[model samples]
Target: MVGTQHAARILVASNRGPVSYALGDDGELTSRRGGGGLVSGLSAIGPDAEAVWVCAALSDGDREAVRRGVGEDGVRMIAVERPVFEAAYNGIANSVLWFVHHLLYQTPLEPVFDEDFRGQWASYQAYNAAFADALAQEADRGAAVVVQDYHLSLVPAMLRERRPDLRIGHFTHTPWAPPDYFRLLPDDVAEEVLGGILGADRAGFLTRRWADAFAACCQTLLGATVTTTPAGPEVTWRGRTTRLGVHGLGADGDFLRERAHRPDVAERITALRAETGAGRKLIVRVDRTELSKNIVRGLLAYRQLLTDRPEWRERVVHVAFAYPSRQDLPLYRDYTAEVARLAAAINEEYGTPGWDPVLLKVDDDFARSLAAYRLADVALVNPIRDGMNLVAKEVPVVSDHGVALVLSREAGAHAELGDDAISVNPYDIRATAAALHTALTLPDADRAARTKRLADASTALPPSRWFLEQLRELQG
Candidate 1:
């Protein structure tokens, strides 16, 4: 509403916005801005572009701000009712869609789509409708609207129905499931999801593998026609062709390097070095305790390294930052607890009078993570399936002495950095342990050269460039 004098020509729609509000005990509201690819991309376009970001009001303060008509310039927050939000977000999006896309469901036990699921699906539709309505109200005729991630898969189609003149684009941040895996959803549900995405003028993914998987799902489920062209793959459904493009999000190398050297990060680096002992090597991983991150398996691999290679017992330390995520879901709560318990078991088994082999911290501290990145001798990023593991690209850019990357083949970043990284199957603990050993023992010169190449590739399509490229293509 801040820029209500004129309609916005460009729009970005997502679940979370660039800023959030907090209500202090003094009954006052304070706003904190967030940083990410979308934020950077929007900034790169400048205010002259007249872009409006449409997002959900996710917190109590945010809801209050919306009720009060308090908002940032060029941002609109839709306050969906709490019950509907929970049903759509936690019930459907996180529990069902996330599990399907990430292949996290245990085949015989889960995905019972009963009456409860149907109700949640209704709420999900309502959530998408809310965003579509907001965007329809704010966008100018022929405005380019970009919708983000799985949470709003239905938004593009809903918006299209309301405003056919608008240019619509949908980008999926998670890996797209293959036809076989995606078919796990009920037939009608799967078809609806595919048709929803096909309503876009263009659909973007992080890698070619995911993009192809999306097309395969559309063809298999919706009888869509897919063809390859010099530009990219195109999917034709119901007499409309939607172009598919890959925009692999990369590390903000300049920001990471600059922030990693700041006074706060330096203090954390000194503290971590003191705790890790002077000559011991540091193996570092920073991730949310999301099931797809495979943190438990990563810890088990570290344990295997200690058991198989005794020479590394006192010479190496594993520094893990497994921050909490989605604790509202019982599955994620259990996963977070398991990560903590396993870390304790390893430390209890390996700690000596002066050496703690595993230093585990569950707090979410960005400065500390940057410090660990700068100090890492071997960076571990072993996600089961990821759209793109930016940590695999980030550590190399910030490492003070150059770190060897132990990456998983399943990660989307592997498509870009596999040649330089020590790749392993995420499910094979022994192989991952071996990869870690190989990373640790890599020759200093070789490691430095690989790190340099990784840094270059990681920054090739930075956030701003990635966003601008997608906008340009969608505009065309």
Candidate 2:
């Protein structure tokens, strides 16, 4: 910023940036932080890096707030502005792409990709175009521009056509469904999505399975030459060779340690423990209300446990923090309502005056989540499918008391943490319930050993190192 070359200027285009500008209770504009792998990884880049993240502003107030924030160190925080943002993110990103990647589409008899879908597709394009314009404006020649997730899939091509001199990279943090499932998208949308990504100088996915699926799509659909390996893919497009690599993301152990001991978090943990009563063992889960979370099944599993092993009912609690995600999407709203109904049913059947069966929270509070992590005796993470579920790794490393994990085989973390968990199929409520019972009843020595193993694996890579690894590939 002070007359130095800042490495050509790093530009990041995503659906939402790390910080959100909203009105605080005191009538002052306040900036709230973002959780998840992105915030940690981007923060690692620090202020000196030539980075400017451009994301959509969800409201008129948010756009005004972002316009003010855009002054920080040449940080061009551009918001694409309303209605389109909601339709693209909640509608196409979550309802369409997310469902496709997780295989969550309701395929009773046939798949639907009709005119309404095409209208939503147009909104998706407009949203991507907004980010593309921002990047092209901020990025210099040879600058590295990294676009994230399914929300901005079209940005790579939109920007590349305008600024071919810049280096672009795309990383998908979710599964890339098999070609058969993926082909359900209309021909025009399918071609544009693939071509947009192929516009990058490099691309990344979590596992080899997802990476291979991407390469196959390019081969079959785009007729591109692709060479694949265990962790990377090579694709040739328009006579330029773009690279692909996999870097398994890890939890920030130090940050967790620091936050876990924060004064506010300690207070929250005390209240939660006291409110739940003295002898209850806590099983904690923090997730957005996504279809792939399998929240309803998890609730059923808990019910099965209370019914099958009634003795544990009086002593165990599932403290679930499920935030509202993609609420504008009817399917997600329906899923949230369904989860609420299930929670109510279980409480009606099992609650006592002193104890509610499930302590459910439907809001976002990162500090409270960390507090729950510290208080957990058992952590439940059972995603039906995931690119990588970091909760399985993070909870073990951050918990103040050592904790056993009940994990699903479908989670990408299963490959690393399976040895330390009581593994179960996410679909099988009976088996998951049995596993939960077993975890709570695990002997102290066995629990301690498994907890130690899980903790060790959880912090294997820090966020700074994760981002550096990806850039190392790009630089080389």
Tens-digit per-residue lDDT, 1-476, candidate 1: 44562298999999999989998899789999999999999999997998999999999999988988899999999999999999999999999999999999998988899999999999999999999999999999899999999999999889999999999999999999999999999999998788888889999999999999999999998999999999999999999999999999999988998898899998998999999999999999999999999999999999999999999998999999999999988888999999989989998999898999899999999999999999999999999999899999999999899999999999999999999999999999999999999999999999999999999999999999999999999998
CA RMSD of all predictions: 0.9, 2.9
State the lDDT at 413 in candidate 2: 81
**Candidate 2 at residue 328, lDDT?**
68
What candidate 1 gets wrong by more than 4 Å, as runs, is: 1-6
Candidate 1: pairs in clash: none
Model 1: weakest 10-residue lDDT segment is 1-10
lDDT of 1: 0.94
lDDT (Cα, 0-100) at 288 in candidate 2: 91
- lDDT for each candidate structure: 0.94, 0.81
* Cα lDDT for residue 350, candidate 2: 97
lDDT of 1 at 101: 94
